[model samples]
Structure formats: structure tokens, C-alpha cells
Target: MHINPYGEDPVRFAVELAVDPPSSAADLVARCRAAGVTDVTGREVDLDDVRRFLDEWLGVVDAPDEAARADRLNALLAAASAYPRLTNHAGDGWHLHYRDPDLPLAGVLRALISVGTALHLAGRGMHRLGRCAVAECRRPFADVSRTGRQRYCSPACANRDAVRRHRARVS
Candidate 1:
């Protein structure tokens, strides 16, 4: 069965990109492919454009409250101008696309990330996306945990914080 592309994967990819953006168009294309986005069509990608888009996306992550976050995301969705359509572009099987045909890489990413983030937030919880609670590494993350209590970006950060707390308690 074809998994919905407009789901956790794209949100996770957005977090990954925001945390450590690609350095070049080739790197972006490769990373997209690695993230299972095979339809890398349309105009040649501009690295600067992609970076700028990602910065705008981070606004959604860093918004102060649910309303603010929704407002930021709505702006992105409006900018995407995406409409749902069925496509089997790679002959994989029929699936849904939320973008026009042959949009540039940046446009495609904008639609994918915006729509995916909306789906994730609405499906999971509005608080599902945020920066890591660890003070030193405030990286963006999409909380895919079953319990929905992910605070740190990775286990290492969580463990480090836990150990620090333990030492403070001992002291």
C-alpha cells in the first residue's frame, strides 16, 4: 500500500532540513531523494531560495502559541496554493499530490512541508512541533512519539540533561 506522502515523513524531513540545511542544490536534491521524494521536477533549484524558504518555515516552529503557530502555518499554506490531485508520476501507484504539476523544487518543497506539517499537527496535536527542550541544542523536531512527550532532539541530549539533573540533586 502506498503510504500517504503528506504525513509524518514530510514533517520529519522539514525538521531535518531546518536543523541542518543542505549546502547546495545537488545536496538538496540528494536529501529529497533520500527522504523518498522522487518527483524532483520543474525548474532548477536555487540553494538560496531553499534556505530562505526553510527560514520562513522555522517561523511556524518558533511561534509563541497555538494561534500564532496556526497563523504562521496558514501563511505558508496560502503561499503554497496547493490543491489535491491524484498522481502516479513514478509509476509506483496512484497517490495524492497537493501541488500543481511541474513546480520548481522550492515550490514543491513548500507545498509538501506546509501540507505535511498541517496534517501532522492536526492529526497528532498542535504541540507536536517545537524546538528541543535542551538549552544548548534548540533544534527543531516533529514529535512522532506515541506518548507525545518528546522534549529533546535525541536520546543523547535527553540523557545528558538527565545526568546533569541527577548531579545537581546529589550536590
Candidate 2:
């Protein structure tokens, strides 16, 4: 009976999907399920809907300032969110859901991502999300590091950039 709040996991999932988008509807569902978004099952999900949501969600990821990010997230929240409710369906434990009870997969993802992003930025820091600092690898990332100073999408990118800087210094 673990509670899965729409926080870090959903934000990381959003970053993963944004950085390396799924190739198909099935792939999207599979990735969501793999991420423990179990409610995605038993719902109608269309590739186009997911793509549209991701396209709009990228607006939030790429926003240049906190205000812009808030604005973009507000749009998503407005479109997707509803009143919070509690349920214990299938003995999954009592938890809050920020969407309607019967939302489809795409709707669930939209609400999850919007609310999750808001919660993450609010609970963490507004600047906790961004693109990788490496010029050639501007993939999106959620900076959940201890210092919240993550600049690269992953350690590989960080190491690559570090080595590149060292070569530049020697040259």
C-alpha cells in the first residue's frame, strides 16, 4: 500500500518522454506503465493526443523564466485538472487523485504531468527543470540532485562536457 504522489516520478517520466519520445501509442503506454503509472491501463489512449500534450508540455520545459514556466503550466493545469478526490480502489491504499475518476490515459497523463510539474517546481525550486547545459545535448532534465545544480541530462553528458572543457583548456 504505497502512495504514489504525482511528484518526482511523474516529472522524471515527463522528462524522459520529452527527451526521447515514444514512437507509438503502445510504446507510450508501455513506458507509462513501466514508470508505475498503473491507472493508464484500461483507458483509451491515442498517439495523437499524447503527442499533442507533449508538444504543449514542452512549452513548460523550454520556458525561459519562472513566470513563463508558471504561465505554461497554468495552461496545462487549467485544461486538465479537476478537484482532488480520495479513493481506495482495489486496495491500492487511500491516496489523492487530482483528476476525474474515469479519465482516459491521455487525460490522466495530462493532469498528472501538469500537477506533478507544479508540485515539483513548488516543492523543490522553480529552476529545478531545464535543458542540458551541453550545447550539443540540449535535452530536458529534472534537477533532483542533492544540490539542485544539475546542468546535464545525465552523467554521460556531464562527463563528456567536462572532458571537452579539459581538451579546450589544453588546446
- TM-scores of the candidates are 0.96, 0.95
lDDT of 1 by residue, 1-171 (tens): 688888799999998998889988889999999999898854679888788889998999999999999999999999985679988888979999899988889989999999999999999999998888888899989999999999988898999999999999999
**What's the distance in Å from true for residue 154, model 1?**
0.7
Residue-level lDDT of model 2, residues 19-126, one tens digit each, is: 788898789889998998877767897778878898898888899899999999999999999999887765757888889988888899999989999999999999
Worst 10 residues of 2 by lDDT: 87-96
CA error at residue 118 for candidate 1, angstroms: 0.2
Point out where model 1 deviates above 4 Å.
41-43
The whole-model C-alpha lDDT of candidate 1 against the native structure comes to 0.90
- Global lDDT for candidate 2? 0.88
Q: How many residue pairs clash in each candidate?
A: 0, 0
TM-score top scorer: 1
